[model samples]
Target: MAYNVLSVIPARKGSKGIPRKNLRQLGEDPLVAHAIKKSKKSNWIDHVALTTDSQEIAQIGRQYGVDTIIDRPTRLATDEIPLAPVIEHAFEEVDHEFHYVLCFQPTAPLVSVDSIDEGIEAGIDSNADSVVFVRDSTHIYWRDGENGYEPVASDRKNRQQMDEIYQEIGIFLSENHIVRQGRRVGDSSEFYEVGMYEGIDIDTYADWILAESQLQRKQVLYRLIGNGNAGTGHVYRGITIADRLFEHDVLFAVEATEDLAIEKLEESNYDYQIFENEPSFLDYVRSTQPDVVANDILDTSAEYIKSLKEYTSRVVNFEDLGAGTDHADAVINALYEHSNPPENHYFGFKYFCLRNEFRYADPRTAIPSVERIMISFGGTDENNLTAKTLRALSDLDHELHLDVVLGLGYTDQGSLDSVTATYPPNISVEINQNVQSMAEHMEQADLLITSNGRTLYEAGSLNVPVISIAQNHREQKHPYAHISRGVLFLGQAEYVTEENVRTAVEEYVTEREKRETMREALEGHDITNGVERIKQIMFNQNNAD
Candidate 1:
């Protein structure tokens, strides 16, 4: 059996906070037009009605093809009046026998028609008196008392450990007969839950600003890979970009074997999924219909980029040296620059997206004596560069401190301990593994021995000179770590022996003028604001399209 549902949008002309708010422009349509158009688009709503005391709102409704324009009295439009009487008046004036009445507010432009239809279905299938929308509230409560304000509960807990509290949002549904009794909620009620950002209601200027931002938001997908061999730079880069795009919808997709990537995202607030192959990932992308797809998997095939372009308007890639770079809308390679490159390529250290810690890092003045040196390869240093560098630096025969930073995915954490046992008592070794404080160690170190990957740029952001080595032939192709960027690049992993690393460290330590020159070179280039640069490139092109 089909049930007849009437959706009512009650928009008063005058608002206490924002004048003429209902008739104000939101995107291409006025605020009141959103509810009317949504009601007409719904699968369950049978009729759409608009009730307002202002003729401006009525005219706006007529333009959106509302079924009826009911005149609401001025008395019922005041701030103190309850919504039930206005809904009742609308139900009576529509003249059609509607089995249900839906109350949708103009302030809630982010609520989708699908949520509305589900609320109606939930109300009718259960034969409930009313249905309301709610979201989880994490706020702690304190009540006023004779002495002062006191905790509502005797027990205190962190927000993450607090009991769940649900607060009502902007949509309501009720049976027509129940609404006619001048009541919105009766003995029976059902709750429909909405997401935190989706339940945004516009009342004050701050809320209006948030609603406008949400309205312009887009959905993005980050496809990348991470492992013991390839390192976790891609996953960390994706997290950096996603954090900047908080207003937009961002998701991370990795393979089932990417346990390192999974562990990293698990510690974050963002959500992710595991895919079996390209076809399954594309199917998920097709279903979600994201506005853009960002490929950070190092190198991509032409067919894969084409497949992504089939669903989204823009496809952006990172550090791509493959043929798929031609098909992408944009390619950002912060470590390498291309000669005779395509018009879409953005290369150089100016596009480096620093981690959150390095963005606000303290300015460094150098220790002058080069007492501390940081040795970090990456998350999973397959080459055991930290051990090699530590062993080589132990031959310095001076009082030196070595800070070895290991990521969550380092497979050779134990091998470093074996190497440190062989170190001289004057050369102390401390390994900081699976820790989030990498920037603090880097700040204290006078120099760093890192791979020719993303870590070198992080060193440059803090003006830390580096002795760079390539873990593989592909990383050897990274061009930004040469003498111009405060880094001295050694050959690939198989060729860079202990003698080469020890000699390079001795030069930076004994020669203060060389370290000062490297610091001046790092200061000549800007590399911290690359997140905002990439964000503008992704969002501005989508908006133009």
Candidate 2:
């Protein structure tokens, strides 16, 4: 039987130079991501394996489609250790027979697919016992005999006469025979020269800075795909929850077209797969098979839902309407329906309920002293009016802090970014705070300057007086009425002027007794924790089923 080619990436935890350098974000990806990506792209190698002493690196390697991971002993990861011993150690643990193996370093963040292919091909094609990648060095030279200061070359300008200089960059490929023979590289060896940039290794601060500069300054990058939209609110809410539950690097499979929701997702810079139509949706889901899927759609088919259930154990649904139509493993909804209710329905808190689930802090002293007020309209702005409200509040008399939140559904991020750049500095502004820790940020606010959306319920639940900007007709009728009763809703088009915003801030500042009155009305009203309770219910039901 022909032996399969195996790739090994050894990543150790302890480092003397940079702390946790493997996980550091370089440009759009982490340092190790470059090596992992190159390994996956190689056609010659059968399996891309990672041998790591760190659990965190293993988790990260798994995300990028590593076939098998070998946990190395602490002894092998030390700085004094040799690569040959570690490589031999991995062979003992895996107990797999292979024709050839490639040793990859996790520190190189710019390895190319061709470089991997070249090393593997050289090993197989040249009938060589071992192959290693080396690069030409322009920076290093040795003095002639007695350490003379003259140029190393007899004729400095002679292009062809200069001796070619090359150095091994530690990326090597060898057959099992070479290692079993107890030799680092066998007698028959081949050297494959790669580019200078691709040969860079990240070990010290200098190496890290150079790699980061290369990544960040590189022009012509792949166009990023946006997170899909069920609605602007739905996308941000889902991302908020997903970010908290999993690491920030987790990807979500969303059922959305290339709409505003997806665009917003793109702007927020998340790895996502979008299903354009029903048939495409199935193909996309089967191919990607994400760890967890956050479904914002109301109309997931029974066949698709069942297929998803079979494929993965974790499927969380965030539905605005028609939640129980096909029955997801877990469903988060604002209201329950009799005909099609989810098996484990989450229905205690509204989507925009203020995130005031504070247990460690006092409310009275905490509330009034909050210098900043953040006004956000969920993921999609439905109406792009939150920016206007921030502009209006800029004219307030007492030099109050103002923050405006942008949704993923906003028409353009460039316009918003530009507007935010020009907005007065005394007023702080934030975009797409998502839904996760937004409540924590909101809990510290003296007041909420917001639109009459689900966030109003969030503020009302906390009894935070709102200078409501009613951006839509529906919101004007629904949540704007609270603004009149001190929950303060300004009409979508009418009350959002600079003068009105100043008046609202003045009233709230002057009336200290009103703060107490509102607090009493809102006490014991928040119930966002029901999401957790529903999660438990779904988990138990899944086990039962």
Candidate number of the best lDDT: 1
Segments in model 1 whose C-alpha atoms lie over 4 Å from true places: 1-3, 78-81, 136-138, 142-170, 379-394, 406-426, 483-485, 541-545
Write candidate 2's Cα lDDT for 230-286 as tens digits: 245555554444434331235545545446556656776767666566577656656
The C-alpha lDDT values of all candidates are: 0.84, 0.62
> Using Cα atoms with residue i matched to residue i, what is each candidate's TM-score against the true structure?
0.89, 0.45
RMSD of each: 3.3, 13.3
Q: Give the TM-score (vs. native) of candidate 1.
A: 0.89
Highest TM-score, which number?
1
Candidate 2 CA-lDDT value: 0.62
